[model samples]
Target: MDGSRTAALLGVVLLVTACGQPAREPGPTGCAGGVPSCAPSTAPPSTAPTTPAPSRPVTVLRGTVQAGVEAGCLVLATDRGRFLLLGGDPTVLREGAEVVVEGATRPGQATTCQEGTPFSVSAARAEPATTR
Candidate 1:
């Protein structure tokens, strides 16, 4: 064959050889292609925003019971703050007796009795004074 024809044939063979070769690197996608078991599925990233849950109210309290500002109810005095306890026997709670008052609390029961947040007492226990 003439020199031009031989060169053209050689160029075509090189192009075909390059086209038939497999890709050596997986790149950013991270998975191999065409060996179906080897390639990880390509899925679009999730766009949903994350959010925190709302906080809940307190349900338990331990403190000393004191007389309400008026009468007919009682107040719990802890180191944290005072709270008005309802729904349990107020007689068991003396002015200085330590007690465990269990209930939910909310702002503004709008009572003439106490100046603290109102708590509904589900159960009560008078913790005895330590002798020491």
Candidate 2:
């Protein structure tokens, strides 16, 4: 066959293949009555959903300061149990005396908890202060 005839045949084949393929349409929209003729989309909406873990409560730990770790953490042991109090001012807490420290008990190491250490309230009185 001549080059022109072969070229024409190839063009026809290409056109047929292109025409056979279905064209993709835009997603449906939820526009109101009798306006743009758009319908609600069957496909689900895309969202960056997140499930945040429940927040831990602020625990008041009353114990003797066991030992001090880095970043103002005192290992405390009370009647309840031993827990690493997130942050404690060294001057306020002593080695043997009883202490009541209020802070959040985070999941991991106490060292990192300093930043998120909820609200710390401490009281160190040898005897309950009485008014004269």
RMSD of 1: 16.4
Q: Across residues 7-43, which tens digit of lDDT does each residue of candidate 2 receive?
A: 9998888667656755435545534332334454677
C-alpha lDDT (0 to 100) for residue 94 of candidate 1: 69
Task: Note the Cα lDDT for every prediction shown.
Answer: 0.74, 0.57
RMSD of 2: 11.6
Candidate 1 lowest-lDDT run of ten: 31-40
**Candidate whose lDDT is highest:** 1
> Model 1: clashing residue pairs?
none
Pairing residues by index, what is the TM-score of model 2? 0.39
Write candidate 1's Cα lDDT for 1-132 as tens digits.
999999999888866775676755563466443333345446677789878886556577888888887776678898779988767875666688798877778675777775778887777888765788
Distance (Å) between predicted and true CA of 50, model 2? Answer: 9.2
**lDDT, model 2, position 29:** 57
lDDT of 2: 0.57
What would the TM-score be for candidate 1 when compared with the true structure?
0.50
